[model samples]
Target: MSFDSRSVVLSWTPPPRDNNAPITHFSIQILEGEHSDWSRYQSISTQNSDLKYKVPNLKPFTVYSYRVVAINRMGASEPSEPSYLMMTARELPSGKVRISEAYSGKPDSIFVSWDPITQEKIHGEFLGYRVFWKAREEDGELSRQADIKNPNQTKISLSNLRPYTAYVISIQVLNPLGAGPSNTVLVTTKQGVPSTPANLSVTSVSQTDISLSWYKPEHSNGKIIGYRIYYNHGRDAEIYTVNTSSDYNIYNISHLMPFTRYEITVAAITASLEGQRSQPLQIMTDVAGPG
Candidate 1:
């Protein structure tokens, strides 16, 4: 018998005693796996006279054995001895690697772990694993990859990631032939402090109030929940603070001394942390007029 990854060919000699009647046909029976019962597979006619038959469409990496029975006009003969066990050649893995755990370890890194492929699904010798990742908002072509040479290593930590951004991660098993289908997961980095507020300017001012306007920070690492405005009349004067929601980019600070020069700075705030303040801008309120 000869076999490959998906088929087997068998050759046999005809029985010496054909009884009184000529041989009608031959029946081929097959057994699969270790404990499977025998079942009829195919039948061959004597007219062909060819002693060899090739069975096709067999599964890869499976165990199989075959037996033959001869039939004549008189009766059917006992089954012949079973052929030696045939094992198909191994192929690529049939199952996907599963991501069991994935989460942000820090503002700039993520931790990931996966479940190993089962032995039965690993059709060939396991070479290793490949991990692929990229920013969720970026294109697939920009993804980065990492190779794990050891099959037992199923966990990895990815660093140098953008804070407060989402990422897509994929894991696949590798064999001599190629990599198997990959499983993917999505994770987001932890919230981080925002960058400094930008473009602090004094839009309009009055004797007792100052109106300020500014642009958002270039890198708002997380959602901007609010902002803090710090202002003081002079270096030694007590600094006062005013808070405003993210919904507004302009704010008016009231109850300031008339004609006083004040140094002011602005900083952005996230739900978890506050960022650096912008460069201070100095402005003088309009002088008081006759009431």
Candidate 2:
């Protein structure tokens, strides 16, 4: 039997030695290479149905072997000879596409652009490009699709997106031959100041130092580069810390007055902006330790 360039179809007849028992089904086993395991590929339930089976999704640059086993009331029969071979498609896709996203100034839109593979590498007749995206949020996932009918089309602007939300995206090129593998990317819509950090607390305190911890914002629109720390008897009177990735959850504050109480808060930071401060946490340092 024949399958696609990267796959093969297999068929076989039942064993002659039935021992007066009727055949029940057949099982196909596959091995990608000599060192690979013989795993059951597929099973057929009908005794005399289409004994043929199509096995697809084979890698182009690898070798494979397959065998078949017949079963009846007694047991399974001896495995058949291994049919081993290599497969290749008419033209595999070129892995030279680039994808990027940028803020489009629209609060609910982003500009997505991509460069097609070089013409020199496109072995098959180009058909078009298909772009797929899914947004993941607290409630659930939402999916959207877009495409360019012309193979030469390069850029597309996606609108009506959620601000400060992330979208998983990928693109694949299609040809008369088949659809090639996809290039995937993650894009976070433009973000604004994040919500306040959560669960701020005082982990430890001492005569001259205080330790503080806090959870990240419930929704961090983009990658959190670091955090800013503020502490003073008053509201962030002092920029206690800045540009610190020091474990967003914990921070040790040294150089505090003995037997003194102070107020502190934290803010998450991204590439270009600092988020709102978390609720204040108070720390009362113990009296001076025995010097």
Q: Which predicted model would earn the best TM-score?
A: 1
Which ranges of candidate 1 are over 4 A from the true structure? 1-4, 14-50, 55-58, 62-87, 234-248, 286-291
Cα lDDT tens digits, model 1, 1-291, are: 887877888889888898667777777777777666665344433344357777777777788888877877787788889888878788888789989899997999999999878866777678888999999887745889999988778899999999999999999888777888899999999988788877778889999999998877888888887788888875655444445555448888888899999888888888889888889888898899988
Each model's TM-score, in the order given? 0.76, 0.42
Pairs with steric clashes in candidate 2? none
Cα misplacement distance, residue 219 of candidate 2 (Å)? 1.4
lDDT of 2 by residue, 45-155 (tens): 434435777776665434567778877778888878877654434466555457754444553676777886763344456767878777765436556888687866788
lDDT of 2 at 129: 81
Candidate 1's TM-score reads 0.76
